[model samples]
Target: MARNIYITSIEGHAGKSTVALGLLYTLSREAKRVGVFRPVARTSNERDYVLEMLLAHDAVDLSYDKAVGVGYDDVHADPEAALSRIIERFKAVEAQCDVVVIVGSDYTDVGSPTELSFNARVAANLGAPVLLVLGGQSGAGVNRTPEDLVQVYTIAHQELDAAHAHLVGVIVNRSDPDHLPQIIEAVSATAGADTPVWAIPEDPFLIAPSLASLLDAVDGELLKGDSELLLREALGVVVAGMTMENVLTRLIEGSVVVVAGDRSDVLLATLMAHASETFPSLAGIILNGGFELVPQIERLIDGLDLSLPVIRTSFGTYDTARIITQTRGRLAADSPRKFDTALALFEQHVDSEVLLQRLDLNPPLVVTPLMFEYGLLDRARQQPQHIVLPEGGDDRILRASSTLLRRGVARLTILGDEGEVRGRAAELGLDISGATILSPFNEELRERFATEYVRLRAHKGMTMEHARDTVTDVSYFGTMMVHLGLADGMVSGAAHTTAHTIRPSFEIIKTKPEVSIVSSVFLMCLEDRVLVYGDCAVNPDPDAAQLADIAISSAATAAQFGIEQRIAMLSYSTGSSGSGADVDKVRAATALVVERRPDLAVDGPIQYDAAVDAAVGKSKMPDSEVAGRATVFIFPDLNTGNNTYKAVQRSAGAIAIGPVLQGLRKPINDLSRGALVQDIVNTVAITAIQAQGVAADSAAAASLAASTTTAAAAGEQS
Candidate 1:
């Protein structure tokens, strides 16, 4: 059966088209065959704009006529017949693709009192999960209050449930950032844990009216520049009536300036602003009031290479501005930049992996290693982070860096001699120009870093000279970059031992205050699921306290990557079936986790079979929550964890994407000496995600401190 998702909204212009486009782009990267079906389009132009955009990007193979369903008028005339036709059309597309995205009707002039009911029925008939896109602004043109958002979610949920369709998730689109936290809290509380909620902050660029859109809205005549150039987006509008200096201040990048055509001075100033480096590039200029420029001025404009579009409108500046403001830019086929902006917005705001999981369309029943790696790359690219690779001299590292850069997963800094690195890249036929190359020994900051290093290790009697020598090592240099916030994170160990790779981080970066011991986890990308195996690369034999700490750290690492924290403390026994020192250690660790972090779902002293296979798990430990659904596994010792991860990697042909060290103040991951190019790419992605979490935590701490200080001052004043 083809898994389908219906992208629908409560009203018109709620950004459902952008959401559908973004989802199609995301799905195309993972699935081989994907198609789109708009169940009820607004027009009968025989050209679907959404379908054309997808085809322009080569995201889909279907034609526009085949992708579109009945028109709005047809659906309005006969609802039942139209729905049946919609279902049939959906099935036709489903037959040709592995997954099909069904776009719901836009609530417009063909509006019926039963529009919502009609949409719900279509979704139910198609047996597709619905992703609801709710506009953040209410009818009052202000940010929706928490109560208002909750009510919207409640109404949609009730309607979807009534139709017996799954409400996969809710996306609060075009939201004001200031009101997001409260709205998110309210919606989350009302929607419950199973339903995910995401809020996308308003991006002016995404919704900005293009020059072409403005011209069409006001019925203006183009006086200069190509019609194609006029398609460029105008992020803001400036009415030029003030002095040149004042007007220049109001002109932002991609802004259209409206002025009288006879005001040649203002026109000349606008042209100069576009040409100068001191001012932002203008999107276009609108000459209002039916005034034409003089022949000399027109000749002057022709003499200059005027790239900005100039439009002549019969209306006044105020009326033209009003028309432009009312124009909402559509994602046309030729608007590649706008498409990119929409994709970035959706990726940044919508958690695609979680959304796919909710739609039941990803991590296929038979998950190959390729699918696992694709998921990692997709997740990493959603929010690119800077990751430094210390083993830049290695061929594997260079090749992986090229792949990472090409895929837009992470920005990288390779630590090596620039000449040698470029030469190596040339030899490998790899383009690594996107990565920053640096030599630790030749950098101007070597001495400054050495001084900081001495201060960090002064308790251990580190002299300045000793620190200077140590800072020259690439591992130490990369770790220092992370500590000083020059780089977000570091990945090493391809050319060094695990101890050599992580020692600098331990000495300088240290561990988080909440953690007593640092540990490691290998993300075992199994056939059907990704599992976290911890204390695998560090801590040879930890005591019960350290084991408990490892479990906590491993759970955190798993959660960071979107994996649910169902922890299984692995051993030879299944729930007291055997007795030994190792088994006792696992039991103690499980007890500690329950006491210290009761929020985590953990069970222990379970065999591997019981931890993975549901039938065996039920037969062995029937009452355990973590037994069959364990996504994170904590072994008793390095001998078990390391050997188990490798065994699984080799025997099952799985992709092991880690040895990601956890509980560090900063992220510094290690790769195997025999790692492949893809392995390095995966590790770098993991490090970037770890860095993002650390940064977020720091920001939250700073915000809390500022709030507390304000409260204290207020109390004193009172």
Candidate 2:
């Protein structure tokens, strides 16, 4: 059955675009022919609607029926009579597509309940499902209530159901990371299990294009703003069916038409040209389901000289356009789940309880071998590395293994009995038996191991029998390889705790003398943006000096990732805004670091927003360089650090990369117990980079000392 998607909102500024685009993107990936149609759009100029059509069109490569630009003639008529004709337009757009995405409009002035009715009317006419976008924020001054959302949902659902349209879910957008937990709790209290909540993250990319921006982009002027027509609300289009006639006729006067790329032909182009000429107030066209623009339409565009621009998008442009109009451009960063990674990001900012209820994902910061393997696989695709898998693999393991090897990411090592491993590989149709498979009970290791084992045993004052038994495990071989310079680093821990993996290494390969502690840093990468959170894994409750150490260590680590570290000592307060023991902890930690290393610049006792947002930093603690623009956050305690890092990840919708271990004596790193193949690859690269840095530093210091000695000797001779 075709998925009937509808876009709505509880109030304004609750990112409808983010949720709408996510659906469009995901569905397009599934190869569906989708359409978008808006029932009612109040904008007169064609440009206001062009961006939505263009983005959906270009981003997904979906061909759209030429969009009709809306003008004064269509909207000046009686709103009721006009709406009927608009509904007819929507029906026509819905007729040619499999899935129709309907966009909604808002009545910001008088709070007309009819605005809600209009959305229901469109959904009811087409029998589509509805999704509403809402907004919430932490701190006072923001008002988001369960009752408000419930009322909106209830009213829209009741009307749509009566009209035969389904209500699929609600998306909360643009929420404050700090208040995400509260908002989720409220949503759960109101929306029950049946209505899924997709909290869209704060994506400035989805911020509603300003009237001025639209005007500038299309070289058009806004006919109305606060005085004439309130531009604060969003516009939604609706597609009620898959028939072209139905979709086109149902299109409201100001609606944009979304057609699939594969479906764009002469007939649809003609229809769009006719619609644009007939309705002087039509929005542009959006191509849905990712179809490339054909030359025929490009020729038509040149011949007709139509004012309306065309946009190709994923899913169906018509449905996506409908959603753009339906949601009223109120989507925010912290809204409901619109993207896959979006859910992961929101889970971090939200309360653990509320997060668990909203999305069924709870990442235990525990590093497992499975996690390491997965990580290694990802890294393998991006770069070359040697990835090790545990003996006896399943389909999941085999698929990951095959992909990594085929991609030439890393050399593969399977630890198990050769015959059993081959059997398992054949069962899964994977020929990884060709990989270097070593048996734990191999006699080669047994005989050679006895020789080295005896030597090491005598050196360490132990018996040969005891040494042989102790080093008999496969992990022993793996660690020994690293010790013997066979492998650069060893990443294992799918079934082992961090300590379990680290213990063997600590005993066999001791730390460097200068190293004081072992800690970890999670490299949070958001596209081109990167931030580092340190000691999140090893240090539970570090002292002031220890935090200072973490700050220095994380900064150095950031340099390895090509990021300039402007450290922020994260706390609940901003520059002593609130006083508490926790605040004091951060303050003292900041002081100790300054005292210990006067050269290392660091600032702390600031909130999360200030650390990342330069504007916020400038506004709050104007003098501190690290306040609003900090890249590194040193948390007062592990509880706050771990939770805050994850919260920023989920709530702010940021990507959290590590728990990259730091301050190791050598370049040995531990992987999560549940690590993927990619994780292993990244850990290895990171270790290599760290090692390379150590090598460079040693060389530079030696060069400096040599130059100094030569200069001194020349001065004595003179």
Candidate 3:
């Protein structure tokens, strides 16, 4: 029989969907093939989102018709018959996979007195291990203390025992950040040594409903605004009951404003405020009472391009607000934010090895995009470092900071005025509590940074007065922090040029002892494998030796990220098939690599097709080991490297991450000017990993120097 992970929750809105998604993700990482099954579904006409998300994963191959069993009505009608049918259906799914993840029925209807028992019974009959989930949201009258969590776990454990079901794990979702440690300790003390427990702090963004869900809840019609804005989440709802001035004061980021359709003044003011940089961005606008925008007001705003959603609903403002508040966030496939947040939270808190050890799974074979992303975040979190984002004025930075803090990926210091940064995040309804907001104008830091800067640049005629003023820039201030050992790494370029971001680093940190120049590589994540493309972001036109150094550095970088190293010296031709100065330079670079690093697998003057395609590689260079499976590609120049990476990224549907800089004394990365929030997150994770590598190298160098001194002292004594 295949191993099964049964995820069950006793109450509604316990955030089990996220847990189920998380478990499926963890299992898919190592399991050869996985299956998802829902023994019972909601009584409503809509499909099960949790099951759909699981089946949508690249790891699963089952269909909806085959994955779902009976419904709640059938269970209520005949429990025995329903259980029998569920088992029969579940076995069919199990027959085709190495393991299966069974999502227990949701507690939608509160009337079922024996719902928890039913879940336990189902798991026992199916011979599956249960991973019980408890809701830990604490607020107002719903105070679930550490002792309260224990009591709930005790009851759930009793249910599992009575049904003879094995309890292997417990998760406390939506936990209070302040009491997370207490909750985990209390639960673990009672959950027994055999069962591991994890707790994820409640994230406001994860719990907030996207505008799409709110639109559906109110039966809204898109009146105007961008369709993509529907994906923006609504943190809360505001009823425009009063005048425009009063509503403006009540405005907050991700708020859905509900007003009567005839409130032209309110509508116009809200639209104007959203466009202004000083005001908070709304999730959407709902015009209730079955009214549409009037002709005069419509004409006034028709020429203006709005960025938020404006929906029209027939219900009154009061009714719309009520419906919007009850709408919950779904772990849908299209909802990338929720998906990433859930996976990050799970990987950070849960010990997947314990669960995998119980399953006896095999090692992973293929490197999918999702798998690569998960690995990056996991490795970065293992030794979390302090990374500073210099462009704190950007909204994307604030959003990314929230995600980083919530995921516990790294300690962050955002460089900006504390009041401005805090106020901006508040207007946007983001919780960036964990990040330390530092101002570039701090007197002590400014003086210290200025002194160091003048000292480092004294040969270049740098003045103390000039240095003091220069250190007030965010990029300079942040880089100085890294140089002073306050932060492990720095990531910039969201609001500045590449030169502006890295100029301070170049002046202060400089290159490593062995490296002559700093170059970069983009981790090209293909469908099933990841490739490295170097010199794509830095070095305009490198010489033969520089190209060889890039290949060597690229190889080391690939190792850092767990990618194989089969270097391909990309050129116009394969081997000696074509001759030119360009091809000759590649050949020379290839020879240099072979002479320096004889252990590394490398091939020269190879075309792109020959480097990647098995048949082409075999035909071009039959004797070469690196031709068919080259994971690292060294481009001759920036022109070719930049265009080629972009082409492959678009054509192959690959996720191009980073221009991750190599050969630096410390880890400093740059981002594109138009980077997204996810792009920022990926770059930060890469920066953290680079910091870890830098630390290891420094430690090794220090140990070697100390040993050499000791040896000399011993020789003198002899």
Say which candidate scores most in lDDT.
3
- Candidate order by decreasing lDDT: 3, 1, 2
Strongest candidate by TM-score: 3
> Would you list the rank order by TM-score, best first?
3, 1, 2
**Candidate 3 TM-score, C-alpha based:** 0.78
| lDDT (tens digit, per residue) of candidate 3 on 1-718 | 5888888877776778888888888886666578999988877888888789889987798999899888999999999999999999999999998789998888767623278888888899888989888889533426488998898888888888899988878999988878888999999999878788889878776778888788888888888877866877787888999999999999987688887899999989998987777887677788989876778899877766665678999988778888988787777887665776887778767788887887666666677776787678778888999999998899899889987887778999999988778766755546687899999999999999999999999999999999999999988999999999999999999989998988888898898887778899999988778999998988999999999999999999999999999999999999999998999999999999999999999999999999999999999999999888899999999999999999999998999998899988898999999999888998999999999998998899899999999999999999
12-98 per-residue lDDT for model 2 (tens digits): 445454455545533332223455555445454443342254235322323333222222245445655665675666556556554
lDDT of 2 at 557: 82
When 1 and 2 are scored with lDDT, the better candidate is: 1
Q: Model 1 over residues 1-718: C-alpha lDDT tens digits? A: 7888988877766677788887887776566667888888767555666656665544377887788779888876888899889888888898997788888877766433267668888899998889998888765457777788788778877778788878888999878778887777889999998888998776666677778778888899999875766767787888898887788788876688998777898898888877666777677899999987899999988888665688999998789888988887777766545665676678777888788777666544444344566567777777788898988889889878876776688999999998778655643335588899999996576998999999999999999999889999999999999999889999999999988999999998999999999999988876556788998888999999999999999999988876789999989998988998889988998999999999999998889999988999999989999878788999999999999998998999777887889999999998889988767878888888787798889999999999999999999999
Better of 2 and 3 by TM-score: 3
lDDT of each: 0.82, 0.55, 0.87
Give stretches of model 3 more than 4 Å off.
1-3, 11-13, 31-36, 46-67, 77-100, 110-127, 134-166, 172-193, 197-349, 441-473, 711-718
TM-score, predicted candidate 2 vs. hidden true structure: 0.43
| Candidate 3 or 2, higher lDDT | 3
